[model samples]
Target: MKIDAHQHFWALARGDYGWLTPELPPLYRDFLPADLAPVLRVNGVEGTVLVQAAPTIAETEFMLGLADDNPFILGVVGWVDFEAPDAIGQITRLATHPKFVGLRPMIQDISDVDWMLSKTHTPIFRAMATSELAFDALVLPKHLPNLQELVRDHPDLSIVIDHAAKPEIAAGQFNEWAANMVSLAQNTSVAVKLSGLVTEAAKDWTVSQLRPYVEHLLDHFGPTRMIWGSDWPVCTLACAYDDWCAATDQILKDLNETDRDAILGGNAARIYRIKGAA
Candidate 1:
């Protein structure tokens, strides 16, 4: 089954999306399942992993509500206050829902790079491990070292690096990101998402420009550990939905069918442990 492993839905009326403003006209409007269903059907995408666009627990409830109504959404990756006193309690309560697959702490937005390794939040990570939840790390290259440490320390915690650590492809900045990614791949068993690359590239980016990074990911992580994601409306800023999918298809044309299928959907299902993946 083809799965758009990372996509988001948000309603501006909710007021929880602090970063989404009217200046970004393309994504200012509400994006729900109905808006995405037609394209998914056209592309033969069977399922999706609905991710959080806001940091509030209330938004998590909103996502859960959407999951309740949409069967195509295989799982919901919501957000949580990592340093909050009731963090574990929030995790426990969210884990009760079968669709609540995991939580993302929005590490990229935070000013502190070493926040993920905080001693104060150790128990929260443990609680997540106890609940058997995945950790979607939304971080930049600078945080890769600290991320590597966390991945090594918490082997039980299923950590998936979101957007391949969001490498800066637009500005031709690759050496440091590539070196860090190599380190993570060599040292930790962390899974990296092949999503959000388009957004990180130039506005007029070509598949050729993105191919090198894609190749690096494949070379290091291989197919079984790599997952494809659309990054959806955000990706629209750089490339259309179908164009990104096409670019991915072209990039993976050389890989065998089994390996291609794994990158497209199988790996996501396995990494997130989505129920009824087939």
Candidate 2:
């Protein structure tokens, strides 16, 4: 099954997403499964891993509710109260629902880049590893060094870097981001999502500008460690969903069919522990 490993579904009126204000007109509205199913069909994608859009347990519950109804949603990566005293208990409860696949701590939004590396989260990390959950790192380039440490301390944890650490492609910030990612790939088994590149590039971004960055990631992570995502309505801020699917095809055109399949869906199923992976 072809899986879009990273995407989001949010209702603006939920009032949980603080970053999502009226200023961003395109994404200010609701993006539900009904809106995405046809897009997935047109792109030949079978299912998707729905990720958290807001930093609240409420949002996670909402996504889980959606997953309960939408069989096409392979897994749901939701948020949890890391600071809560009973965070582990929360994981235990959430894991009871088979479709709750992972948790994403919005590292990029936190003021302290070192928040994830805190000693406080050690048990939380342990619980996630015990529960067999994936850690979706929503981080920035500056957080790469600490993220590497995060991977090291919890070697058993299945971690995937979101948006290639949101490289500053529009600002042409490549060298540092590339070097950091290369080090992460070299030292740890962390996976990465091949999504959100369109938003990072110029509004009139061309395939040429994206080639070098995407090539670097593919070379370092290889298809086995790289997963595909749409970032969807958020991606719509940059280009249409069909455009991203087309661009990804053009970029991976040289890869063998097996490698292409791995990045597209095979790896996601294996990483997220979804059924029918092979």
Candidate 3:
């Protein structure tokens, strides 16, 4: 099965997407399943993991509701108040929904770089571990060290790094990001999504500018721990869906069928526990 492991669905009227405003014309409006289904079809993608674009539980419920109606949505990585006093109860409740496969705290938006490692959040991590839910780290390179610590502390937590830590490819620098990525990959339990790179690079970015980072990830995480994601509407900011799909294909052209399949879909299926994805 071909899966777009990460993508988002949001309604502009929801009033919860703080980062998505008219300022960003491409993604300022609604992007629902109707808008994406054709793109997925044309790209030969069978299913997708709908990730949260808003931090509110309302958005999570909204995505889950959409998933209930959309068979192509294999799973959802929603958000919850991880630091809330009733976080365990919240996680337990969310886990009852079979489609709620993972949780994502927008760590990148949080000012405290060490927020992921706060002692108060440990119980929440434990609850996630107990629920067998994956945690999508929405982080930047600076947050990686703390992320490594979190992975080490919660070895049972299935963690996937979103957007390959959002490398500064546009600035043409990789030493710091690559070093942290290599270090983080030491924990076999952690995986990464090869998504959002096009938006991070120069507007006219070439595959050559991305090849080094992609190769670094392939070398360190290997295909088993790597997953592909379109980042969808956000990706449209830099390029179209088919364009990103073609770029990803070119990036993985050197890999044999087995490995390529894993990065493209298999790894996400295993990590997110997406039903019937194989």
lDDT of each: 0.91, 0.92, 0.92
How well is each residue in 1-278 modelled by candidate 2, as lDDT tens digits? 78999899998879999999889988889999999999999999999999998999999999999998998999999988899999999999999888999999888989997999899999999999999999999999999999888888999999999988899999999999999999899967899999999999999999999999999998899889999999988999899999999999999999999999999999999999996555
lDDT of 3 by residue, 1-278 (tens): 89999999999888999998788987888899999999999999999999999999999999999999999999999999876778788889999998999999999999989889898988898888889899999999889888888888999999999999999999987898988898889856799999999989999999888899999999999899999999998999899999999998998999999999999999999999887778
Candidate 1 versus the native: TM-score?
0.98
- Model 3 misplacement above 4 A: none
Cα error of candidate 3 at position 239, Å: 0.2
lDDT of 2 at 172: 94
Flag regions of model 1 displaced more than 4 Å: none
Clashing pairs in 2: none
- Reference-based TM-score, model 2: 0.98
How much does each candidate deviate from the true structure in C-alpha RMSD?
Answer: 0.9, 0.9, 0.8
User: Which segments of candidate 2 are over 4 A away from where they belong?
Assistant: none
- Candidate 3's TM-score: 0.98
Could you tell me the lDDT of residue 37 within candidate 3? 100
Decide which is better by lDDT, 1 or 3: 3
